[model samples]
Target: MEADLEHYLEPGVGLLQDNASGCAWKNAAGKKISCAARETEALVSDLMVDQPLLWLLVSFSVGILLGKRLFRGN
Candidate 1:
């Protein structure tokens, strides 16, 4: 799962520059509030809906790993 770092680019150095503003849920001058958890849930749900097959395969792999770990002594 580890990725090679030799070919990594410095972020915001080329055409893919990042915006100066932070996530919309952050407060720059007032009391801090966040919807990060809800936003993350929505993002994951969107990904699952968009790629059902990928999610299915990932879930199957996780289930197999858990089963092996839990029943390894049997």
Candidate 2:
């Protein structure tokens, strides 16, 4: 809330309470922006969205492989 982030970094104080989501926007060459706790669901969705067709093909292949195996002896 101020020019400096001193209060946010104060000792014995929590930045995010009650499981709130927060983000820090920074600009630095070759420096990654820090983030809050990671979420598996978000990461997976990102992966799927990154290469939708590829993931679709992969899942379809697996499904066909499983179906063949399961129905082969039937």
Candidate 3:
């Protein structure tokens, strides 16, 4: 699934490949940090556990905005 997604994405569009068994982490500014990615994903998943609807809306909005810019024609 990850490979399929990467194939469609343009180069340098924020894909991170974990070099180890653990997932990679990133800072608040979206910069990759030295933390485990699964840990961060778990933390975030826990934080939004009570707001699944809100999370869906926000994710959808952000995806639309990002898709517009990333797939826009030159």
TM-score of each: 0.46, 0.40, 0.36
Per-residue accuracy of model 1 over 1-74 as CA lDDT, tens digit each: 11464247564543333444554444543333236666788999998889899999999999999999999996
Better model by lDDT: candidate 1 vs candidate 2:
1
List all candidate RMSDs to the true structure.
18.0, 11.5, 20.0
lDDT per residue (tens digit) for residues 9-71 in model 2: 755335454224433343332134232224556787898889899888999999999999999
lDDT of 3 by residue, 1-74 (tens): 87778778776554344434334442342444435676798888886997788889999999999999999999
Candidate closest to the true structure, highest TM-score: 1
Global local distance difference test of model 1: 0.68
Best by lDDT: 3
The ten-residue window of minimal lDDT in model 2 covers 28-37
Error of 1 at 57 (Å): 1.1
> How much is the lDDT of residue 73 in candidate 2?
78
Give per-candidate clash totals. 0, 0, 2
